[model samples]
Target: MARYDVPAENHDRVLELLRQLAEASRAEPGNLAFDIFEDIDDPTRIVLLERYVSRDAFAAHRETDHFRDLVLGQIVPLLTSRTVEQLDAEDQ
Candidate 1:
């Protein structure tokens, strides 16, 4: 999961970039899901939910061209802050 606090001036551009990122990420081999959400109370806040088949798959995702170009190169620079966390599902 990832959370981004975008500057007001950059919010729209950030959202556009995120849409492209989600599209590319979802097409990756081990990607299970790539979802984007907006914070209702805070229009500048964006959240991403990313899922993969395995740890290695997640690592590979970080190494993708689209990830580097769109996320690191473009979207990241428009944000005031960014946070990422790794999560796992509890066994039933």
Candidate 2:
């Protein structure tokens, strides 16, 4: 999971980019699920949820051009703050 706090100036762009990323991520070979959510109370806050078949699949996602070139290179710079964590599902 990941949480993004985008300043007002970058909110729209960040949200658009996240949605684009979510769409592209869903097409990845080992992706199980990809979701994006907006905070009800904070318009500038966004969250992402992702699941992969395995750690290798997740790593493959990070290595993709879309992930590396677009998300990391473009979108990341627009955020004021970001927090990401890896979680293990209770059962799969």
Candidate 3:
């Protein structure tokens, strides 16, 4: 699984774009799960949870053209900061 902690002042503006990304991601072949959450304490903060069948799936997503355009062209500009974490599931 990979997690993203994102803090932004413009969450409202990106909601539509994020929705699009979520829809696209969910339809991908190797996607196991994908979600978005907002912090109750701070609406500006969002959490992104993504799971894949394997690391190869994650890598494939990174290389996709949509992922690059969304991050580099859309979401990156709207974010104040983004922290990412990758984890290995012990049971898997």
TM-score of each: 0.95, 0.92, 0.84
Which stretches of candidate 3 lie above 4 Å from their native place?
A: 1-9
Q: Which residue pairs collide, candidate 1?
A: none
lDDT of 1: 0.92
Residue lDDT tens for model 3, 10-86: 77766666777778887889888778887788777777788888889988877877778876688878877777777
The residue-by-residue lDDT of candidate 2 on 1-92, one tens digit each, is: 98988898988888788878888899999999999888899988988899999889998999998998768899989988889898887775
lDDT of 1 by residue, 1-92 (tens): 99999989999899899999999999999999999999999989999999999989999999999999999999998899999998884548
Candidate rank order under TM-score = 1, 2, 3
Cα-based lDDT for every prediction: 0.92, 0.88, 0.73
Q: How are the candidates ranked when ordered by lDDT, highest leading?
A: 1, 2, 3
Worst 10 residues of 3 by lDDT: 1-10
RMSD in order of candidates: 1.2, 1.5, 2.4
Off by over 4 Å in 2: none
Better of 1 and 3 by lDDT: 1
